[model samples]
Target: VLPAVVDTAGAATSKTQVHAEAPDNTVFNWHLGDKGATEAAFKAARHVTRLDIVNNRLVPNPMEPRAAVGDYDQGEGAFTLYTTSQNPHVARLVLSAFIGIAPENKLRVIAPDVGGGFGSKIFIYAEETVCVWAAKKVGRPVKWTSDRTEAFLSDAHGRDHVTHAELAMDADGKMLAMRVHTTANLGAYLSTFSSSVPTYLYAPLLSGQYDIPAIYCEVDAVYTNTAPVDAYRGAGRPEATFVVERLVEVAARELGKDPAKFRTQNFVRKFPHQTPVIMMYDTGNYGASLKKALETIDYKGFGKRRRDSARNGKLRGIGFSAYIEACGIAPSAAVGSLGAGVGLWESAEVRVNPIGTVEVLTGSHSHGQGHETTFAQLVSDRLGVPLENVSIIHGDTDKVQMGMGTYGSRSGAVGMSAIFKAIDK
Candidate 1:
């Protein structure tokens, strides 16, 4: 008989008998904030709202499928891999240091004009490693390009989670605390940067835009037989937003309160608000933002619209979501303390040629996000040069020297900041 299969995330979460019950199958089990304190607050709350949220797996199919070309320079004892990658530096680091392909100085990875990544191409896969290794053994360059079918089967998938979340509230409808438990499906073997997604990237954002006094979150990540799951569009923040917004909507309905007013009541008004789950929000005007959104949507006329829809034998509903995301993965000290193996910082070098043209070498890669245009505009505006005269160079590990790559919406914020600093120097 074939071995028992646990391919789907739903099957992996079945409690009757764990499909992945082996000790090693448990990838991560960790919690944020004081569980005891949050539970006690929940017990004493005048009102409580609970929600069970399930997000299925998602596959990223970029316009261009992933491909790799590996060339070995036999005489120089060096290897060059031209592949579809978001971060060539990280790819080189993993291949040389961890995969034992070669020393860092000998292995050079180049990513050129990648069509798109959507977080899928950010990983170093077996095909690239194999191609590079085989090039040496065969004494020739090896090239492999992924077709659509191959991509669907092998590309790192994203966002498979089962979550149970609760919000504790006082009699006046003010949020007291929040408690959340999640089971993330990592699928098969761990991929690059997979371990951080459902943990640090998910739980910390559970507080959302609220002012809950206490919050606790627990995450248990497991391995299944499906393709390896990692970050996708919005990564963990979207999942966290769904949970918080759904709970808030339900809570408003149960309290016979307008969802807009209910959300406004709990919005975090103060600056430098420290959440129990390890986030320190510096500042925000949640009430103003909500008011503007409500006015823009004509929220007061929603009842009339719903009644009109009923007359037309149709259903009408509106939803509100207050989302907060931590972007620009930066400040090496912070990421280092949080278990990042590599520094999350970006790097850049600015050079002005004698002909009055500028070359800006950045670690940020552009996979359809137009980093070249935006970075060029920044340099052109600052340096008083025409946009065409400023060239943004990136992707190749040899050219860049080092980089954290582009993801988590960091190209503009973190990457440009590095370029700005270099220009200043």
Candidate 2:
């Protein structure tokens, strides 16, 4: 009945019904760095700019919608769920342990030819759980596939955040400190990996290619009467980039400085720069990258282009964005320290057949990322084998013992590294 209460703004108001007993609808409050110190520094800074970024919810429209088929084998006392998932092993684990669908040994999850996930298919949903459980009760195979309309209405959405960010700068336009307060919308219920998305996944990356001595971020995750919100594409990193870049751009404008120049001056120039946040960036060349970008885009000629466009009553403007992301997800110890419950490492098995053909089994799932070709090429290069002789297998829990899945663009960095280690062994 609460049709209008769809966002965190509404959920925070008294008119909205209390979904959970938590005060102010806050699921958790996550902060990084010293907020008090950053605020004190902001007071003494020469220039400070406050920017509010409102990112609306987005439903991922993958080429193929979610589909599931559940079958129970009576004789074997086992269940099989064929669903479109990014990680079948994780799905099997969640369904087995948390959902009580079946014991891990008695249940199998297979995700084959998932059209595209873009992070939406990573989490376990109600339909798949229902299908698997119903199959056992009815003693028959249960099948369900979401149509385009149903997919839009039901699929886990992504990136609904309201952020108030401030950047403090010195007289010379060098960034001194930054502070951010974000209200993240987790939708009606918490999805798998939901809590991490707005917290550890977000605030840690606030230092986005910048070398601010002091930075602080506080995120209040709220529940609203909306579809479950989760990761999409770049996930939390994209949102962080938006906040940082926007603040930097506006700060440059207010201080009457060149955007690119301002970014260059503030770019993390040194290696092994330990940010006040949790992230410790080991290496980057942001200044050189910006120089190359300016050259490639003909940045100096933008005034002429703008003049030409205005003569024809057109508005033309170019903007710059400096962003950084944390890919290659794990080393379980590091991720677990950040509140991740499961092991973050990916697993792979490499087998050289007696016929000289190679079979590589990985926990990483690929919808449109071309893992088959890339992994096959890698094996061919590493082992001196023909491309056709190498085969990559994935997306089946029964076949691959375990996987941490693919999100945060970790497949190439983490998955391939695991494959390389397996090949070495």
Candidate 3:
């Protein structure tokens, strides 16, 4: 069970009461209170059958780190930033507010040739702000790139969570209720989306593809001594999937049932099924995908293969993960209601040049997602113009007036959808 840190001593008490300070030298008298309270409630109800705990830590290995460069024209009162960014215009707006910069009319951000962001490039980093501030300071262009180790300590990390998951199933191997209590590590400070990542992004995905009738999840986002944890690749979905899949596997083994068969029986077959969480899933064929995967993997013939491997003194096991994800983010209002500081809407403008050529500017910035080619392909296909004639431009705040940068696989879905609409006009 996950133990939540409820309280701690504020200051120096005594020599005997003094414990070692955290890695960042933040010292306090530590106390562990309200530990396992959720688990206790579950146990008292007799609804909890299986419980599992998983703890994750941070890993910072930097090859190509973050870098940003900004340019401002004192004459035109405009600004531009060329750096690694997931969303440049969003960075411009946020940095403008935080740094007490001039109106957004005087600011522009450009994300150019970012190598690898993972999830690090998604934030409005201090380095980006410093560059813009320094450019005005030095009266020239300013560039700052994160070294390997700076990226480790400064760049936001991901997936530091301690989770307690419980699954209740009936005698005939049907899941009745699933409950998850997670204590998410928010590090020393709250980063851009740190608070929402664990609660809205992670916990809501616990429903997976199961047809369970009742499910409840609560997340306690707490401060700790480490880098802020945010989105990484699949972000919260992967952790949620891992917990559900692992628990399901263990439950199947305990019930002496074939794992695949158990999952097949519990698959959600209807459309627009609503989970106990906030999400209402759209079109999906969970059973069809599971059946197709079983056929491709030859699930019935696995026994023969396992026996053959046993003869060779090697234990063989086959595992399956049937999961569903919520991608493309959501409507701006939908995400804003969940405590998001900014809107999640994307922006794009298609400008037709005098020669009937096209310039497509988007709020989404692409480090390695190939916005130049893919966006051009989309324009060419839609406008019936030559691919070379359609130039996709992004990462400049001046070019695209407003934007919500890319993350949560929202670039293609939200950003591209905006581009398509603009081009159609």
Candidate 4:
């Protein structure tokens, strides 16, 4: 459904008449940090630098496009769906509860051998929903697969946003505060975790690798007539990093200071440094990482590389952008308070057979992420089992009780952490 754009500037008055549910063409409005504190800091700053960044949306073309097959057993009032999904449990939640397709127990969802997700396969789509519902009605299996064109046309796009951010700095070039106003284009309808992506996930990381004492961020999640936008790759963190790093780089240039020196001066030195935003970074050696990176690149050798390129009638330049993310999907209570509909916790089951072999069931479904091998390695190293003797299971609702699935790069940090807990238990 194409939405009528009320305004191209993503104004609050913008209207997307595509769906009756979203009357104003707006999905959600969210804010974080102390605005009063941020404004006061800005007033006191010796320098104020502003930058506008637009993270244009793009389609993720997976090697294997989305496909699904739904099977129903009329006699037992049961249904089974073999589909391409990053998280089968999340799909079942929406299908059974939200869509009223079937009871949770009676519905079984399976995702297997997925080629790639890149955050696209995590959400439930109309094709698989209809496939399962029609199977139950006709008492036969129903199947559908998206060709490349359909996949390209229908799958959610990633990171369409317009942001205006300003950094307030002292005479010595120390950052004192930050103010960011971001207008995120959510497209026609909100995708799974779409509201959370630009709001909670995006705003919290505005602090980046710095210790900005005051940070105020506002996100206007607007609706437009286009493909829905959802989480992809680094999700909001990358966008936040882009904003912070770009602003920092610009601030350095405006102050006539070497960018590396400016960044090093602002590196967060302490463990558990809490920014004005909601994130609390537990530990990182930002300065050390910068030092190492600079050393590895050999800052002194840039002149030689540039000279060699100059001889070939080309110009060479070197630049650096330092960024840090507060890792982990983390702390369900934390996410829920920020308006998440569901808890982000993952589930895992470690089943050790009598034959001394191991089977690991994780809530995470892999699409070429090597989850099977990585998760199995954890079991092998922990249980003292051979890697060949360990098997990893995932992406089946009946086989695995519950899982939040992999997105926002959580499969490794959050998913495996769950398996580690199960193994410990």
Q: Give the runs in model 1 whose Cα sits over 4 Å from its true position.
A: 7-21, 332-337
Question: Is 1 or 3 the stronger prediction by lDDT?
Answer: 1
Per-candidate Cα lDDT values, in order, are: 0.88, 0.88, 0.72, 0.85
Q: Per-residue lDDT tens digits of candidate 2, residues 111-178?
A: 99798898999999999999988998999999999999999988999999999999988788878889
Instruction: Kindly list the per-residue Cα lDDT of model 4 for residues 337-395, writing each as its tens digit.
Output: 67664777888889989999998988888878898789999999999989999998888
In model 1, what lDDT does residue 165 have? 89
Could you list the CA RMSD of all candidates, in the order they appear? 2.1, 1.6, 5.7, 2.2
Q: Write the per-residue lDDT of candidate 1 for residues 1-425, one digit (tens) a residue.
A: 54443644454444423344455457778888888889899988999998888888899999899999999999999999999999899999999989999999999999998998999989999999999999999999999999999999999999998889899999999999999888888888799988888888888888889999888998888877778999899888898898899999999999899999999999999998887777788789989999999999889898999999999999998988898988888875436657775778899999999999999999999888898899999999999999999998999888889898989999888999999999999
Clashes of 4: 1
Q: Whole-model lDDT, candidate 1?
A: 0.88
Which ranges in model 2 have alpha carbons more than 4 Å from their true place?
1-4, 332-336
How high is the lDDT of residue 275 in model 4?
A: 76
- Comparison by lDDT, 2 against 3, better one: 2
Better of 2 and 4 by TM-score: 2
**Candidate 2: lDDT of 290?**
95
- Residue 411, model 3, lDDT: 84
Model 4 CA lDDT for position 405: 82
